[model samples]
Target: MDGVDKERVQKIVYEMSKGSKYFENEKRKEATINQKIEDLRAQCVLLTDEQISFYQTVADKRIIDLEASRDLSKTWLHSDMDAFYAAVETLENPSLKGKPLAVGSMSMLCTANYEARKFGVRAAMPGFIARKLCPDLIVVPPNFQKYTYYSELTRKVFSNYDADFIATSLDEAYVNITDICNDKSVSSEQIASELRNTIYEQTGLTCSVGVAPNRLLAKVCSDINKPNGQFILPNDYKAIMTFISSLPIRKVGGIGKVTEHLLRDVLGINTCEQMLQKSAYLCALFSEHSTDFFLSIGLGLGGTDTPQHKLRKSMSCERTFSATEDESALFQKLADIAEALSNDMHEEGLCGRTLTLKLKTSSFEVRTRATSLQTYIHSKEDILAHASKLLKAELPLSLRLMGLRMSQFYDVKPGRHDPMQKTLKNFIIKDASQSTSCSSYSSDQHLRNGANIDPSAAEESCLSKFESGHLMAVCEPEDYQQSNQIAPVKVCRPGNDASGIKDNADECVPQVHADNEGRSNPEESLTNQNGKMLWWIDDYICSVCGAELPQCFIEERQEHSDYHLAEMLQKEESLNNRRGLLQRERPVVSLVGKISPVGDVARKKQKTSKGKFIPIDAFFNRYKKD
Candidate 1:
């Protein structure tokens, strides 16, 4: 990395990617971001001096409250293995050391060594592009099992320092060592140095360490000094402020490119210090979650305590391939992913009631369809049956990627060893029998009570608090009569019968249902010619108000959507906020870049690469099981 020509690397990457589909996709995203900036500017102009003053008061009050919440009593350390995957490869084949190297397929790269970094090679970049950057680069297929084994070795070392340390990924972790420091009568710097030495001795891999008063700062600090180094930030408020004042916003976790561009280009906020200078605008424009984060950056505040483990919410599998419109090929790919995901789920002892189908078109646009089922399912047959339905609705198709995610875990684990007893129709329709087989999760009863399966059904939720999407609707709940909210309130299994599970499956039919997003479908009238229903309208109408509005009435539609969202929130309030809270927990389903996977249920996460990484987004938001 020290020898890397950053300018040259960017030039080559740009030249190589310029005419590609991935590049075009990035341009589309850039245009969207530009429009958002323009809209923000427009809103800024609309704000009066009084409004600015009012927002300033609001920002100040929030800042005071945020400041009071800062904790400096503990010391935290973030450890990041240097070029983890690549390092492991080099360690395995010592001869590969000192050569330009990368880990991943020709389609995409997972990571590259420091030597390769000199040639602009890095994680998530396509291997083909990396080849153009450095033909001398040695690309190695990723061996995740090997990586996991080494990760365990490093984690064992981590346990010696902080038993509750959080392993974010195979490569990095956050360890709170306040008690260790206090009991040992040693400083945090000492602890970090010792931890690094111990990890190297245990795993035979070099790592860098960052010691700070909180997890946020520690994570940022860990990256300040690259491969095999350590950076420490003291507990003093002035020292913390001084350290953060000039920090680039992107360098902080959660501040990805879009957030970086929005803060920098529109608000003219390039550093943490400038974030506060524009706090009033931030408070006025962004949600409280986002604004609080921005102000906290200005104040250098971060969580100092160990994060409690959370229940695993989701698991997924995806793949990238050469562009194809062949529906059979697509189904084949879906089948493979289902099998892999089923294996991953079973191996991890997880069964989820919700299944989400993710697809990326050849144009690089991503679309998702999700549904919550009545029973917990992990068998291949169940996953495929549900996923095939979601996929079929999206055809006639051309795609580059596809994925399936399961979430909203059930309390009582259903047996996942059963073969399909009922067809796809059974799952879509109601099951009135005493209960579904614990294994198949569907029965003859389900088939008998079937309703016509609507390929497109009520989407999960529009629960995003993030203000990024251009035409995003409010949490679009279907009208009462058509409402299909199926929160996993209970798990029903066979009363006394057991079932056998198979590792295979099949089903899907193509009937387009209304989507929560207002995105016009190619098959439907985009402008509602002669009052033809818009393809994206929920059940041929607004989900919230049940109005059969024409597509031309965008403003009226948006207002109705907003009112519906407000009304739903009010109803949630009356229900003691439980529905809203649960809905919020489910990530807003959208047609965008890949939905960040919610994490693995077991210790060794199914770390399959989509055969590539798109660093355009930092996804795979992981949650460890308690």
Candidate 2:
């Protein structure tokens, strides 16, 4: 019996023998005590506290003993689908069976079915490489929405057995059945079998479970016979050590290529037990953390204070090459890494300003360097530029491992409906598009979908889950047609004439009164009235129906300069509306844009720059009409 079960048995006895029941009738009480003892003995193998604790002792000892002799056992269960995505695809499309298959994108593979594994196709492998291995392999894109639904169902199945059942990831979990089966009655083998059977019945998917004294052994044991099988770690330490020591160093936590080489080549330590033996040496070789790591493994101390479910602070993607060192090859690999990292960011609606580069040398010198940009960048070019710069600055060194980490996240703000800020953001967008603007432009312009633009493929998957927004594939040319076709109304620029008769231009720029009276210029006010009137004319509504317009008008613009002024206003309104919508629609990605009130100091700056700062009156006054 385990520690959990032993406590339960003692508690049951104390509760039953404590008081009045035994004293009420000595003859009856003696029989009841004997029966209770027999019952406890019967459940000793699989006993847990959750089992019924009989407060009222029974009178029949022989019957209780007979019940105890008829042994009842409990089995631990773990069920996971084999190559969950590819398998699901195979199940639906029968033609996919017998043929190698994988689930991922054109860039990389997420997971491969067993058939694909035989041909050296594996998870995270580049699709091109996988295709070379198995030319006929069918590649299916990931259906994350369906995967999430299935994950929730799997969690529900685990909870049905034990609310305390711990899920490690999407497809893995551990259950402590010691409390469920009581101390003496149930066997671990029995518990394992029933749980597997229950999961199959509920989910129609088979899984493998491992029964052990603790979770550490259970995880390792479970992987031994996968795809509907179970294994148990017995009551022995030396045998367990031998089993663990024979495995690769990668099996041990924190034992990457660098650490593994340090242990095997430098320290002459290879298996778990060998590494465990040299814990002190490892501590000195690496740091305090490395020492604690090996020591914990040595003692089979797996569970830590770390909670099972916590938000991932950082996400990284990396790859190891078949060859030792090539800078050009590393560049291509870096591009792939950047694409994957950015795609994940877009999916999670996250933006990270910090980029980290990880490298491993042939001599196994692990080096890492990171730099944080002024703004979050999600483009492949930007990611590669930064990562490559770090590598170049730190290189002329051999390489074995390379990784990219996107972290130091900033939340994406929702769309706003502010007119002035919206107009300003558009001007910035125009500035950014004219040049190779970094991610800051995308961040400032509120053009988040710019990061999702895939130049290679015309058919891109656009998913806009928000009610007000859309997942528009830029390739869908028709979606932008109507807005793009509507040319901007002509607004004449105030050009200078050689004659110096600039009455029309000068009249528009109304001179302030010499007395500095409160009387504002009527002609200046005429432009203001025209703007207010024109704002009502072309502001973001159907001129005919007056219904609120869709966002497409602001996004799609004609190249003609005639409509520049009105077009700018329309775009500004659209940006503001989009910004407002983004903020309220999805607060998770909200990057809060504060509005600072313009004071006399700001006016002076605007005046000197000739409205470069875009003061309200100059913008509306100068560009309101033709």
lDDT of 1 by residue, 1-626 (tens): 57778898899889988988889999999999999999998898999999999999999999999999988898999999999999999998999989999999898899999999888788999999899899999999999999999999999889888877898999899998999999999999999999999989988899999999999999999998888999999999999999989999898988998999888887999889888899999989999999999999999988876654354568999998888999999999999999999887755545577899999999999999998775556778889989999998999989999999998542211122123222112221222122222111122222224432122221111112112221221121133116553211111111211211111121101112336674423222111111122233553464322457556444344333332322222232223223343234433221111111111111111222221211110111111000
Summarize candidate 2's per-residue lDDT along 1-626 as a digit string, tens digits.
11234444345434544553323344454565556545434544343433223211221232243324321132333345557777667756788878889999655899898777766677877776677667888899988777666666777777866676777666777776766656546766777777777767765566778765545556667877876788876535555556676766666545676556546655567777665555434443445555555654554445412234333457799886653567787778878998898776544434466899998665445678999775445556678889989988975766767899987553111243233222222322222232212122122233334342232121112212111221111111232335553211112111111121112222222212211344321111111101321121233332222334333332211111112233233333333334454234422211121111112112222212211112322432222221
Q: lDDT for every model?
A: 0.65, 0.49
Error of 2 at 500 (Å): 64
Q: Score candidate 1 by TM-score against the native.
A: 0.66
> What TM-score quantifies how close candidate 2 is to the native fold?
0.42
Which candidate comes out best when scored by TM-score? 1
Task: Kindly give the stretch of ten consecutive residues in candidate 2 with the minimal lDDT sum.
Answer: 521-530
Candidate 2, residue 216: the lDDT equals 55
Any idea how many clashes model 1 has?
A: 4
Which residue runs of candidate 1 sit more than 4 Å off their true CA positions?
Answer: 411-626
Clashes of each: 4, 46
Worst 10 residues of 1 by lDDT: 617-626
